[model samples]
Target: MKQHTLPALLALSLLVGCSSSEEIVPDVPPSELYSEAQVSLQSGNWLTAIEQLEALDSRYPFGAYSEQVQLDLIYAYYKNDDLALGLATIERFTRLNPTHEKIDWVLYMRGLTHMAQDRNFMHDLLNMDRNDRDPEPVKAAFKDFKRLLERYPNSPYAEDAEMRMFALKNRLAEYDLATADFYLRREAWIAAINRCQELQKTYPDTEAARKSLAIQLEAYQQLGLQEAIERTTELMVLNPI
Candidate 1:
């Protein structure tokens, strides 16, 4: 009886192990997998698209549609709001296919991904300003867009990249100006002046730069530094409000 019981237990354990760790692998060819992925993409089923694309990639790593699979996965990840994985995929694609014909597209996608993830998700409902949020993500997006422009100046995405970079610049300048204003309100004259100076110098063409100069003038007056006040007034004259 003991011998029979031990063999049955071993058989049951094997059965359980087989069921528990079974992978959901498709038996169809890579071509069919890619087709299913495309169907999912067209239907806006990003999670399904990601799954099929990943299946195709694993089954046929060097298949004809391998590159497209990677690209589509990045887009799918973005659409699914899986931004971290999207970024990781982007990094892998860039590192692996640095000289790919569609590298510009990849770079543009990377910049777009950065922008998408940086969006202030609660800002609309909370009536919050985007510029009031942390600036690191915006700065990252700006840098990525800049890289795309420098490396692929004539690419189809260059215009959009430029537009995004312009918006990011304004936001960054606004953040710096806000910091200066915070200091000025607290009567931290030197800190406020430094913030204003850095904002203007770093983002000279932004609208906030002009505002920062105004803040600088106020900080100077508060400190009663006559020479600094005169110099700041001259700057304001040149900026014309």
Candidate 2:
């Protein structure tokens, strides 16, 4: 019995050692790793690209391909739908290389990452109102895009960022108006009026501002504030419907 048990134990130990050896991936040189990552990226294998880039970054933090590796990692994360990782990577790159020649591209990618997170495909497909959802990501995306435009007005990405910002502003304004309408429906006339005024102040040129003025007029009438009603009505008239 002891003899049989000894052989079995030896066989089990050998099996374990073989399994560990199989699991160990051979480390590639930084250049080779970067080349592999680029190939993966070109082939649209985002997860594989991410793994190779991350390994390259970790193994050669200041190597020849370090900066390019970081930038590619951000793109890989974004393509993998890892928005948080993508944003964090962008922030790190900006913080580490403040004067990077391609800083504008980084900022543009950051804005794009935020915009990707802000979109809700299912809700959009259902034709549901974005105002009913959390607006934090939308607001963050808008701010990022605004900062990109402010800092890099001549960036090749500026036009696209501006278009996205326009849509986001309207969405944000609509969200505020939706809240004000909620207050109006609840007979919270003072709160409704305050929200409308705030919306008008923040998003003056938006269609939401026009709707907000209309809401304020209704709220003022409900609260019997004749002077306020008259002021809002006059402004709405000048704004043309």
Candidate 3:
């Protein structure tokens, strides 16, 4: 009986040693996680870096490391082609930590994100211009530029925003002219005259206003309204574009 017990004790000791050797390893250090995130970013693995940085947020929420992680998450979102998310995160940072040294940069990035989103629509409108089409996107682009101008008046983005506004104004004028042209081609004289009149009032400085005047003249003449024709002619001359 003593010999059997000795053999069982030895077997138990071996089992304990094996269990200790196979213990599950713990997670890496916070600093190591940060380093891995940086390396992943450098390697263009933006999504992986975002995951690592996000993990550090709850674990080290008040340290310089945490702040860095939050900042890096914005860049990671941008790099990962999530511009809307990036803009929102950065805007939160700006609102919550207004005194942060990078506030200007955050503002600039937000403006850029909005501009990028606007550009896709603007590009489609410009492409449509070749076929003389809808002006909805052109109107939308102006609204985008207007926001940038009003929100970040002193931002470095202001100059670009101003330029875009100028271009958009011209595009809007052209769209009005196109609408008038469409009405004329369809023999809708009253509609054509109305579009032309709107162009004169809304965009007084555009070549579109000039073309609108010509169309308005023809529409009023076709309707044989002598006084209305003369009135539209005067308005065209007073408001050229």
Candidate 4:
């Protein structure tokens, strides 16, 4: 009986050791994958690096590999000129992991992405022919910056985002003022006045503030309201220089 008990106990201990070894092994080797991907990225083989990182994410699904892959893919996408993909990935990561260790970096990247897409409409319009009037991309960029400001007010990116937001707001307000000027040239006083009012209420710090108030004052004069003109001129003076 003693001999039989000793053999059974030895087999049980061996089985326990096997289980522990199995537990120690990860589904995917994160360090190896990360190193290979980093090498590929450094060699300017962005697509290859992306594929390896994606493979790790798909096969492992959940592990240290997945986390690092998500983090590193941002650079791969950017260097590959996949700006939309890079921005989207960073945005999703920031949203899902607001308290993650790298949240500051994610927020900064988000702001950078938005700022990168910005183009002055006046500049573009002057460069292009009359056929292109689509302001959607500029508006979308503005929205992206606004998202960073609203979502990550305390982030390191917040101050930069605020500055960009202010710049974009002024640009948008200028766009409106330009439209109002065009309307004024067409003798559409009501339309011009409405656009000026929008600038006064929505974007008081931009160049639009001076132009919009001046336009509004002219509109008030043409429409015959001395009091309105005086009030608008005073507003123009008080607006930021």
Cα lDDT, all candidates: 0.87, 0.88, 0.74, 0.72
> Of the pair 2 and 4, which is ahead by lDDT?
2
TM-score to native of every candidate shown? 0.86, 0.83, 0.54, 0.63
**Residue 137 miss distance in model 1 (angstroms):** 2.1
Count of clashing residue pairs in every prediction = 0, 0, 2, 0
TM-score of 3: 0.54
Ranked candidates (lDDT, high to low): 2, 1, 3, 4
lDDT, candidate 4, 1-241, per-residue tens: 9989999999999999998875432445767877887899889999989877776766676777666677778777766766788888887776767788777666556555554555446657787432224445456666766776776677776787778667767667767877888878888889989888886778766676676777777888899988888888788788745
Tens digit per residue, CA lDDT, model 2, 102-194: 998898888789878877888779977768577888888898889989998998989999999999998889999999999999999999989
Write one digit per residue (lDDT tens) for candidate 3, span 48-165. 8877887777667886796577778887887676777787787678777887766655655554454454445565777644325555555655665566567657867678767877
TM-score of 4: 0.63
Q: In candidate 1, how many Å is residue 165 off?
A: 1.3
Give me candidate 2's TM-score against the actual structure. Answer: 0.83
Q: Could you list the CA RMSD of all candidates, in the order they appear?
A: 2.9, 3.5, 10.1, 13.1
**Model 3: worst 10 consecutive residues (lDDT sum):** 128-137
**Runs with alpha carbons beyond 4 Å of true place in candidate 3:** 1-141, 230-241
Better of 2 and 4 by TM-score: 2
The all-Cα superposition gives candidate 4 an RMSD in Å to the true structure of 13.1
1 or 2, greater by TM-score: 1
